[model samples]
Target: MATHTTFQFRRRMRPHRLALATLAACLGSGLTAPVCAQDAVQTVTISGRNSANAASVAGFGDIPVSRSPFSASVITTRQLADAGIGGLADITRLDAGITDAYNAPGYWGQLAVRGFTLENRSNYRRDGLPINAETVLPQANKQSLEVLKGTSGLQAGVSSPGGLVNLVVKRPTGTVRQLTLGWADDASLGAAIDLGDRSGAFGWRLNAAYDHLQPPTDASRGHSRLLALAVDAQVTPGLLVEAEIESSRQVQPSTPGFSVLGDRVPDAGASDPRTNLNQQPWRLPVVMAGRTGSLRLTQTLGKDLQLSLHAMRQRLDSDDRIAFPSGCSAEERFDRYCSDGTFDLYDFRSEGERRTTDALDVALSGRALALGLAHQFTAGLLFSRHEARFNRQAFNYVGTGRIGALVVTPADPSLTDENTDRDEKSTELRLQDLVVLTPEMSAWIGLRHSRLDRRSERTDGSRPIAYEQSFTTPWLALSHAVGPNGMAYASWGRGVETEVAPNRSRYANAGEALPALQSRQIEFGYKHRTALLDWTVAAFDIRRPTWSDLGPCDSGADGCVRAIDGSARHRGIEAEVEWRAGAWNLRGSAMALKARREGAADAAINGLRPTNVPASSLKVQAAYNVAYVPGLALLGFVTHEGRRMVLPDNSLDTPGWTRLDLALRYAQRLGSRQVVWRAGIDNVANARAWKEAPFQFGHAYLYPLQPRSLHVSAQMDL
Candidate 1:
């Protein structure tokens, strides 16, 4: 590898120039004399590029980044491996506008994009089909991750206004067998096996892994396993079929999170993450289990026409026991002593949920001449159904005797049983077309008709509630070539999202679904493509409706509250750049945003900044290959997040923080086999920080982040 890298500084023609030169050469050869030679010569066409900036963007199939009307980012397998990313929390750091929203140990992959939380049910997809993301995700079996910023109404009819995430599964490539072993700080251990083979028209791939991780703060423990299989066959020269299935399970014992005290946010910077607040021995660890399957078929009708169909099904289940301190005493802020060193805690036990989902999509794509202009069009239909069942039992501690009153010991609470079930169905019809107006200009128009039907029921023998709604949204865009290497574009779109009903403890109409939220966005951007680099910059303004929980209702009922109406407006500018030059790879992104609530029923809360969203964020990454050592590379990254409001009223804020990460990788060839090794350290500066306080039930709950950690891994091919 050292001998293969010799360039210090090099310049080359851009991609646009290369294409123009190739076209000129072909024309100069004279088409009239190529008939005999063309019939005698054989040529092989390359499918996709192998460079970082040249790889095809995953979510849109064959569309390149330079041609997309909206801003999007792609994380390839090589980038994931170099950064040692193991979960969604780690992956979101790659984009400056993305952050963790509601992260609990062994629970799920919750995230926020562009200052708004991405809904678990409507904002996530696997291979273009909707899947449940309420539990731990299968990151080990994915080939790439794609994120589309702002509204994506043309593809996803009902979704959060922030953005959408799509996971691309690994497919059968070639015959190979590989095994890997990994170890990390805190007594963690992992092992995995990957195998693939092909014969004639059939091919198959399989992957399996198991991991056991000790608590990052000595207050938790976790165990997880995953298995994935994929099969594909060429039924004929113009037809193909594929199928995939996967299952995963995780068990983790977690410590309860810290909470605010009496309308005042606690000083999270002063608290130690090593402290164990909830030390009850009987509380069980959280457990999660999930299974999913998908099938797809494709048929080619002619040289420029194709038809595709897909269907998917998924199920997830979880059980948990939780205890956390709430409304701590203000006098002893350091120790949170109730009377001297003891406080009452919210003890939650016997919580469980089961979720099921089914999805189907059909699409047709082709090109034709319309109105004397060439046009590319795609028409599709989508249908999805989701069902959820939830159970919970909760209690609050109140001391009995004088000795036990002020200072209480940890004990199990007598919980009451409560059960509820919810069902949701969605159907959408979509059509989009790209028309060529001139040689260097184009126009895109799209429309979607969407419908949603929802219902909810409780076990108390009350009446069941149901709701139905419909919406029609449109999308429009225009683009023009700025120069040989640049393109400028502008777009406008609308979106819709479904809201889960308020909790029974919080509202009188607890199980009734609110009206679906409406959203709109407008953006302008520019993209540039070069031989070794690609860059994009965009500006956007977005608005959407939101709900806030007031303290309590006028009725005299314990734990009963009222829901307030409100809205949010966000404006931001973002830039991203990527490069893959010889012996050097670099990428970076930056974002600045102003996010605020408007039209709130409460005047004090109106015009206040949304909690947990930063005003500005930056991230940079660099990797370089060692010139003296064969197949050796060094990588480093820096991330910074601006100050964030920790309270809903914007009365308290947390200071800005920065984090550093470093890694080393090596690969070598020995005879007919290959060996690879990786070692990395996260949070190299040992920075202590808290991720965010997600809003729930009129309060923001605090979640502590992991401390500095290290991991090492090795792999061998047979």
Candidate 2:
């Protein structure tokens, strides 16, 4: 296993020397405080488990921007619950940069940052360590989610500048069993069970989640299941130990066909409901499924220091078969296919679609203050290693319609033997520290020297050696409170990314490997929180990724042409808000972004907006416990992203859309009243919707959203 660990963090001050101070208050009064004292500082959980007002400047400053040079929006467990969210993507879509990651027949999503690009980290994490699939990890008993939105030079000193996202899973609490069930408009149903216990020095907890739905919109059906278990114990009064394991599986089939207005329609037989069926010409054309299992452990050493260790194995499998449209407008419009041709390529067999990724990681965080240094600080070390492999067999048919009516165009099935396997090992040693320069201002500075050693051994096992590619990055930030809960700051950093997976490169069967890319950025942001409101707004400019295309080149060129003078500028604003009063809570976020690159063949276009990068997006939701009833509540959520470019031509695009989901819950005693029954509705608007990506192949061109449905369930609390 290859690993990266950083150990020393003593450096001269960078700038804006100031100390961080915290206070407690809500935003309802819309009040502001310019300067606060340390004696007045307090600690309150924004997680919403219990209502207390505490000011955490760490959530407000611009000075030390963690890993990304861009701004970040951190949503706590309380924030997620208050909004009544269901999945991981549901949380990620809360911000921008990420385009829809759904692919194949299932809602198997691949997360993207800035654009469709991601670094080796793939943006996956659990309690701060890698949990596998870099894009999206199954949300099982999750507690909080943090989005790092720009060039990542700090948190991941060596990773894709694309960005980073951290998911904090739930841990075993001291005591209690909690159960809840919910229903939504558009036909969404769900139920969850949570149990915890702490006796003397031992504690344990387990949680399970289930969701079922038949979309209100055309051809949309989705269902999900998840479970998480955790164990904790106080080996000693001041020392604690903890471990956790989690698993989840989500299967969502596609109804492929949709209307021109972005609604569901019948491309196949009218017998199929446009609102709840996939319209692929071939029956059982495609299916996708994502399953993950993870194990993690944590141990506290003492009062001033803590340590964490975790490992997880994840897998993604897909089987996709698509029928090409006979008369596609794009084909005719572009003159790529014969207009009067007797037969067109209609059937494609992309069989045995499979991808598996496994990862191991360990890290430690501690508190320390250097002698003679006039500041309090935080220091830590982390290391991780991951492996990924994918394989697929291709097939084709001569005719369309029923399989029995077509002729199998035969080819060497052994071609599948050509599949490639590559093992990448990376390591980093880092020592970063936060410094309190003065009572009014604080400066957080960190320097990291990291190396990524990688090798691509053909499926055949061979002697392994580290390809030493080492680089150093510096992170610095400065911030000052403008008011009690508001602060402004600026940051700068650089980032790195591994070449696209070697498997993808070999899929094209080029005899070589692609080189990794690098990116840089500068950004600023502001934050504030009061009684019923909290938000962070910021903007950033990121340079296009720079790297050499490692694919094979044609005659006439000395080497693979450098990707068309590749470069672009990304700038945008992001905001997150939460408002709660009495038993009602409302939450949401907005992102406004514009990105472009230099125009060149194979190179992303400059004038053309990048695919998956939307110009505007926003989400808002509210949930309230019933006022006139006992153990009852109501929930609603709405999320949307604006239009975006889809094809290289730029003019071809995916229209923007917004969807609203409403649900109700009723908790009442049954029989002896020891158990409670709960029920509700989903997709109140049952509004038809689809995310616009994957339109290029013209196979299964669309992914439809779920329709409105009903759900009923029961749970017991002890």
Candidate 3:
């Protein structure tokens, strides 16, 4: 016999809420929740289960992963804890389609999905509401992270065609009290607590954490603090309200990447990867502080109609300072370091930078029967506003510094002044319908009409720029059930992106707003799920316009003109699998990509591969419970990345690399309390390799993989 937990809800409860409770139970205790509704009350019984297979990122509603038309993945909090993931960049090890895009240590996260870089302004969400991802996002208060691959025109009006990431906030379930203590190499320490309870129709959850980080680097140290609160109330039999707020602060000195020495990639032994080039005596650590809040209200209008309203606000303040290195003395190749490993050093400082974002959404959904066919529909209106203020930055070249040498120059006395301001507002109307044509076949259609207004100005007596644009995008998909647990689907989608002229004096139309560019994606996929195995395979092709400098002007104020001159086309195939049977668990994902530039005006770059995107990648993770020990498990992880092009012409590239990791886990009950311990060693073989080499702003950077390190943690239920 197995123990069971039951939850009871009052009359006329929302189905989506019930599904959420079921998912929570599945994640919390590895149990399955089967729901049964009565005339006056509904009950959910939880028993033994294997996995949680439902997610809300697809936007229609809480749908099973096997039924969704698009490719998606969900990373639960338990997975994060087991892998010791601390930031967004660390998630790349779990998914092959995700890769770094200038993701430096101690800085905000930046990544690419399917060979396309994600736009920071419109590619992130929190509980279906837009939120700025420019600052370090605290993951302690998040229940799960959801990744939706491909065009999301129906969900987000203006977004990158690559994909979108959504963070789900932790909500109050039943009673929960847990504490976690963690440690890593170099004396890093962390502590966190989670508390939740329910009283009558109201419930609340609180999360708090603090971390002191001393990374395996020279003269680099940091600390962070986070606090979050979530609450919900069943105000009436047909109405429910929920709210959440979080505040976090982080201070750290950013590590700068190494540059190529002239036209050649430098040897790994040229300089110690642990050396922080920005470790000047007068340098200050980067400080980022942010607060976010959201509110949601759901009302049952009728037996088949429901209305929902969501609103969110986010604000971030940052003080950035660094001793940056760039360029060489040679005029021919100024973007690279000199042959003797010497480069120009600059004192860069930017303070009093503020960013704010606010979003609101109202939606109505219902199910109906028309023309003898069942239909599920959603109609929504969205509004969002973003604003940014920046102080005058200082980027002054100080002196030259050589690799493996310390040279400190006097800090410049220049201070910051208010200089730049930018504002953007967007409005969108969306409609979606899912029609069941037969018992085993369905079609989904969606449309979004979006309008954007943007303005920017500089206090340095420059011309201000403003623009207004509108577009309509469409999404269509058809899915057919192959069997009881398998489905195949094909989808096509269109999206839009905004572009601005680079703010450089060399460009004739610098800071000017350009016409909106459109992007398109076509995908075919199949998904299967069973009691012990789940798998998905997808093939996708995406295309978007690329902007570059077209013609060079004579030596005058107008040096050049930049415009859209080409298109970037990316085709890829990706597959993911998960299996759990007896005492063994395995998960793996693989991707093969071919990304190139087409129809380019510049002959040198035509038909060339994009920078920093790998041709192939693979990731796998496994855990096995000891049959005799009863309380111990063994864990292992492996990752491999194919060679990545470093230059647009594909003349320079980095070799493929492989990494291996091992860990152990032990769980036991002592005196009516549950305790778990985890220990892990990353990069066990201590392989020296370049993780990524990205070219940005005319400079080439080489980011190296971290050396071997150790991590340990303990968790207790109180």
Candidate 4:
């Protein structure tokens, strides 16, 4: 079978001038609507630090989460560092609806939200610009992580209905030099430095970190390094410019535990952690390097209008030389799946891949008047180009030998260079308005028009295959103040996801790019807010298309058959609460989901739960500051997820599990400088658990969870 890269959009027009013309037209239209000099536009700076319970993720900019007709969460840098969170998966655990899609620590960060997977192509952002989150993303230089749940089509042109995640970069604030030293139970040592300062009209911030961890399960090791720099200049009273650059590298030597067979789920104690299955450990470590740069400009065109422009470019390169357990041998026994594992381990050292991305966005926002009512409007244009190439091959490590045998380690192995390339581009125009219907009520209306083009080619001299499509998604919302501290809201929105072309082996229309899949959502919510507490309860229902793959057809000439049968329904209810009373802080979130596949080609599959989606989940955290012992605080947290289906047939499932963690923190002034110390124990119960993934390439895999781990760190201002 030929290799391929999907999930790409492409276009061929220059849109900067078009964007400018559109902006002018909007301004003209707004001027002639309803005149209201008293309701002129207000200059509002939107940032992650704008509010404690709000995020700037909507078309209308930052608004209190309670007032916005959506569900969202903000994880601050303080929360990240204080909790000793390692990656995106850990960060998203604060939200009950998000869970691990693939638990490949040190290699990738993948997640699912609200029973849907966040796609690698269009669901993640850095400082409001689309970015690839398939690889390791460093957290040391992030100010906050913001998330919008359920259909982010207006703010994000094409994205998963599960929602969107935006990482806010840290900017220069005040003069400070901080250093951190930490260690974990796995013989991991790490150090980081953060420096930032503002002077006159210019400010700069720099962050660097390096970590080395010895493999907890083998004699191998893993290493990672990161460097980030940002600078901003106040060129004039009305103009500001900022630039940022980031570079990261990682070398991972050990693969997380996996089940060799696609069907079996190993018993809790079936496999030992201290085992290395790869024949040659030195050749199995995956190495990755990535660099990103971005520039932004903001201009105050007038007191009532603000214009901003941003551009970003990124390049990522990876060398994937790892031992992958694809499936078990025909005669392998289920009980002995991992006991003395003998499977078709793929010596998957493909020629690796290189991905490049470029994006530009321009937006104008301000106050306007429509029908004698005060209104805030936002308009924007977005363009993005993405290209990727990968060399494909098959270097099989057959199941003939034992798990630890080195006899099959061939000398001078041959590699076949079959290159596959994909190109994607997208252009989008969006407009949104918030109208004050009355003193206690408001309506939000938004629309986005998007055009996408995608092309793919087998660089091994094959003709290119292309796809083009367009869509118009809309957002309608209503919010009303119920009382002094309460708000009620309802919303309707749409979402989109890219589809991969079927290969020759799978369909008669080989290499045909299917139309993008669509999803729609409706939600209702109530929120209560106060100086010391905030909570929200929301219920949502989403509908999306269902697809299936049928094996080889009887008539070989036509290849295989595929079908888009009907649709899937996902309904869920969620409740979230946060409290910060004097000397105490607490947070709790919970979700109950019912996700079922309907109208499948196999009638028996209907009404079954989608693979790997948990039906119920909850998370809670509490912290208390001890007044008697100044500068000291104690923290505790718990996370639990119900049993989830492990296969499309719902014949296999994993047991529900829970984890507990505890931590202590101390802060004090030493010699006019601040000093902090922290310690924590994760998985306090040392429970053994596994994460089930329904598909990777084409097979189901089981991921083992890490055992009890300990962490300690110290930081000091210099």
RMSD of each: 7.8, 10.0, 6.7, 9.3
Residue 30, candidate 3: Cα error in Å is: 17
Per-residue lDDT value at 548 in model 1: 63
Collision count of model 1: 0
| Model 3 C-alpha lDDT per residue in residues 1-718, reported as the tens digit of each score | 1111111110000004322332232222221232222111111111111124455666766555667688877776666666667787778888899988888777787878998888777899988888888888888899888888888787787889889988899998868776656567777777777788888899999999888877787677888899999999999989999999999998988888887887788766455778788877888888999999999999999877899999999999999889888888654566677877888888888888899999999999977778876777899999999998887888877888777888888787385443668899999999998777776778889999999998888756465788888999999999887776678999999988887886678788887878777889999999877667878899999999888786665565566887888899999999988776777778889999999899888777877899889999999988777777765777888889988887767878888888898877666555655456677888899877888888877888888877788887555544
Cα error of candidate 4 at position 84, Å: 1.1
| Candidate 4 collision pairs | 9-424, 9-425, 9-453, 10-425, 10-453
Q: Per-residue alpha-carbon lDDT of model 1 for 684-710, expressed as tens digits? A: 977876666666544456666567777
Q: What stretches of model 3 exceed 4 Å from their correct place?
A: 1-52, 269-271, 330-332, 413-419, 502-512, 553-559
In terms of lDDT, the poorest run of 10 residues in model 3 is 6-15
Write down the RMSD of candidate 4 (Cα, Å). Answer: 9.3
TM per prediction: 0.86, 0.72, 0.92, 0.89
Our tally of clashes for model 4 stands at 5
lDDT per residue for candidate 4 within 270-385, as digits (tens), equals: 65544556545435677888999999999988767889999999898887676655555555543223445556555666556888889999999887666676677888999999
Query: In model 4, how large is the Cα lDDT of residue 623?
Result: 76
Which is better, 1 or 4, measured by lDDT? 4
Predicted structure with the largest TM-score when compared to the true one: 3
lDDT of 2 at 491: 77
Error of 3 at 495 (Å): 1.4
